[model samples]
Target: MASCILMQFPGTSDPTVTVIATGGTIASTADAQGARVPTLDGAALIAHSGTPIPTRVIDSTSLDSSSMRLADIDELAGHIQEAFADPTTSGVVVTHGTDSMAETALALDVMLDDERPVVLTGAQLPADDPHADGPENLAGAIALAALPAQQPGVQIHFGGMTLPARGALKRHTYEMQAFTSSATTPLSRPRPVGVHRLAGKNVVVIAAWPGAGRAEVDAIVATRPDGIVVAGLGAGNISADMGRALGECLQAGIPVVVSTQVPFGPVAFDYGGAGGGNTLGSLGALSAGYLSPGQARMALTVALASGTDPAVLLA
Candidate 1:
C-alpha cells in the first residue's frame, strides 16, 4: 500500500489540494544508460512545483506512463477517490506520464462524480533537465486544482492550457505543448461507481489501413477480447474485408466501436457500403464520436467492467 504524507504550507486554513504523484517524466531522472526513469516521489514533485498551496502528497506508483496498465489506472482512481473523501481537500492534482495521461484523465472524468476539480499534468523533459517544464506545469495544475470556482470533472493542465479530458489527445511527442482537445463542453457527470478494476476485461484497438483485411481482424478476434475499437480511416470507414470481419465480431456479442484515425472531427455516418461508418452502425457497432481510439478503449474497458452498456456509454 502507498503511504500519504501531509505537507503543510504557510496557509493552514486554506482548503487543501491533494497531490497524488504517479511517476512520469516529471519525476524522472536519467539513468547511467542515458534513459530517464521515475525516481522522485509525490513530495519531491510538490517541492519542485514551488507552490504555496496547502497540500497532502500521496506517493502512488513510480512508472513510465507507457508501462501503466488498466489495473494501475484502477489503483490511481482509488487514490483520487480516497483524497476526495476528505472534507478539507478541495481538489486533486495528478502528476502522470504524458504518454498515457489522456487515457487516465478520461477514466477519471467518467468515473468520479465530484464537483471539485481533478487536474492532470506532466512534463515532456526529464526532471533533472535545466529547462525542465515539470515545475511550471505542476504549478499550473496545482493552481487549477486549488481554484475555488473551477468547473468540475477531470482536465489536463499542460503547456499553459487546461483541456477537458473527454477528447484530450497528446498531439506532440516531446513538446511543451503536448495535449489538445476538440471537446468544447464537459462530459455528462456519471454517478460515482466506486472502484472498478478492469484487469480481466480485455479490450483491444485495431488501426485500419489502406488494405487492412480479414486476416488482421481475425488475428485480433482470435484473442477473444471483450470488446474491440477500430481506429478506422477517414470518417471511420474500413476496407470491405475489415468491415466484414468486424461485423462478425458484433454478431458474436462483442461490442465494436468505430473511431476515426483523423486527429480532429467526430466519426460521421456520412458514407454507406461494406466499409462505411453507416454500415458498421447498422451492423451494431457503436461510433466513438469525437473520441480518439485510446480514449475510446479506456471508456470501453470501464464500461464493460462496470456492467454498463457500451452502446449507451460509448456511442
Candidate 2:
C-alpha cells in the first residue's frame, strides 16, 4: 500500500506545480450501494484540473478516507517533502476524499515545515456525477498553490471557501460545501514538530455517554494502546467513572487526551469533579484544546511516535 506513481500531464515550461493524488471522491466512481467510492487515482484527478501547468503527479494511495491509516499519511508527507524541495515548484495540491480530509490535512499541517502551499481538496459528488465539484476545487487549489504571495501552511480549499487545516472540519455530509471554520477567530492546532511514522503506535478514540461505566476505558487500557483520545461530554467533561479509568491509563504510562465532541471550543479546567476538566488535568490527562476528537487522535498518534511528551505537545 506504500506505492507512489509519477504521472505525466500536459506541462508548461513556465512555473511548475505538483498535483498529488490520493484516493478520494474526486477519484471515485459509483458502487452498487450507490455511494461514491474511491476508485480513481491521481492521474484521473490531474486530467480533470485542465492542465494547470507543468505539473508533477504522485499517487500516494487510493484508499477511501475511512480506509486511510497512519502509514499512508506518512508516505504522503514524504512525497510532499521531496516535491517541495525543488525550488521551481510553486506549490502542491492534494486530491482526497472528504470523509476524512480534516484528519489528513491536520496531519500534514503539523508534520511539514515548508514554505509552499499544500492544498487538499475533495468533492462531495463523485467523478461520475454530472455536478461534481472536484475539478473546480482542484483548479482553485492549483491557483492558490501557484500564488506567488500566498502564505505557506497546510490548508483545505473547497466550494469557494478556504481555511487553515488546523481548524477545518467536515461539518456536513451531503452538502457540496462540507468543510467550515470558526466565524470569529481563525485558530490553529498545536504546532506539529515533524512527521512521525505511526507504524507501532497504538491509539483509540472513546466517546463518553450518559451514565456510561468505566468499563469502556478499562477495556481500552487493558489493550495498552500508546494513546487515547476521549471525546468527552459538554465542553470536555466526562463521567466520573470514566474519569477514574482515564487516571488509571495515565498511571499505567499511557497518554490520555481529553477533547470536545462538539465542533468548537477548547477543553478547559474551569470546572471540577471526577470527570471535570480540572480533574482530568490533575490526573495527567492533557487537553486537545480546540481540536475535535478526530483531530486530537491524529495529533496524539503522531506526537507519541515522535516521542514528544503529550503534555508538552498538547500544551
Candidate 3:
C-alpha cells in the first residue's frame, strides 16, 4: 500500500476497487515497425475504461506477458495481496496479458482462498488499435471486482463472462474471447491477502507426447526442480518408461503432480499398468482433478511454497 495512489476519478468519494496493472496487450501499442509493445501503464488504461466507484492504481510491471516468468508472477501476487490488506479497498482488478493470464489467475485462486473478489482481465488487441477491446474489457473487470460475488476464488472477467480461475484457460490466439473453462464450470477463486507470502520454488511441467520416455524426465530431474507436473494423455496416463522416471523424482523427495493434457475432466484411476494413472498413484504422484497442467503446477507451487504437503490437494 506504500507509494500506491488513490485514483482521482471524477466525482467519487470512497475508493472501492484497486486496479493492479501487469503489462499485457491491454497496455500495449504498435511500434514503428508494427511490432506491439507495452507502453501504457495502469493509470492510462484506467483512464480509457473509466471506473464506477472510487479506485486506486498500482503500476506493478511493464513487461510483455510473453516475456513474463514465474518470478514476476510471484511478485505480482504480493502486490495484489498488499492492496487487499488495505482496509479502504474492497475488491481488486488485475489487468494482465492474455498469454499467461490463466496461470496468474489460477495462482491467486489457489494461494488466496478468501471471499474477496479478485478479477483478471486483458485484451487481445493492442491499445493503439482503433478497434481495440481493452476499454470495455477493463470496464467489465472493474465492475466485477466492485461487486460481492459471494463466491470465494479468483476470477477472469472477459467478454462479459466471469469464470473461476480453477478452470479458466486461454483457448484462442487472435480472438477477444480468449478463455474457455475445460471443467463444467468455474471453481470460484482464492488469493492470499496482505503479503507476498507465496513460496518460491522451481517447478516444471512435462507433457506426454508421441515417443516421449524417461529421457525427458531425466533431463527435467537434472535441474532438481522442487516439483514436477505430468501433462499426461487421456485420464492422466503417461508412458511406462516416463512413469518410472517420475517415481525416481518422488524417491528424490521432489513431489510430482498428475494432471491431464486433455482439455477437460477430472483425472481418474480407472486405468492400470505402466504409465497409467494407477501406477502414478502407486508411485505417490498427486492427481489434480480436472485442472490443466499449468493450473496444477500453480497449485503445487503455492502449496509447496506455503510449506503445506500437497497430498491433501490430490483429492
TM-score of each: 0.95, 0.92, 0.91
Query: RMSD, model 3, all Cα superposed?
Result: 2.5
Q: Alpha-carbon error at 313 in model 1, in Å?
A: 2.7
Least lDDT summed over 10 consecutive residues: which range in candidate 2? 4-13
Among all candidates shown, the one with the greatest lDDT: 1
Ranking by lDDT: 1, 2, 3
Locate the minimum summed-lDDT window of 10 residues in model 1: 185-194
- C-alpha RMSD of candidate 2: 2.2
Kindly list the per-residue Cα lDDT of model 2 for residues 245-292, writing each as its tens digit: 888888888888998878866787766888888988887888888777
Error of 3 at 64 (Å): 2.0
- lDDT, candidate 2, equals 0.80
What's the count of clashing pairs in each model shown? 0, 1, 9
* Each candidate: RMSD: 1.8, 2.2, 2.5
What's the lDDT for all of these models? 0.87, 0.80, 0.79
lDDT per residue (tens digit) for residues 116-173 in model 1 = 8899999999999999999999998998888763665688999999888888999999
lDDT of 1: 0.87
- Cα lDDT tens digits, model 3, 170-255, are 88899878888987855533334323345457889998875577998999888979899999888888888888888888888889
| Model 3: worst 10 consecutive residues (lDDT sum) | 188-197
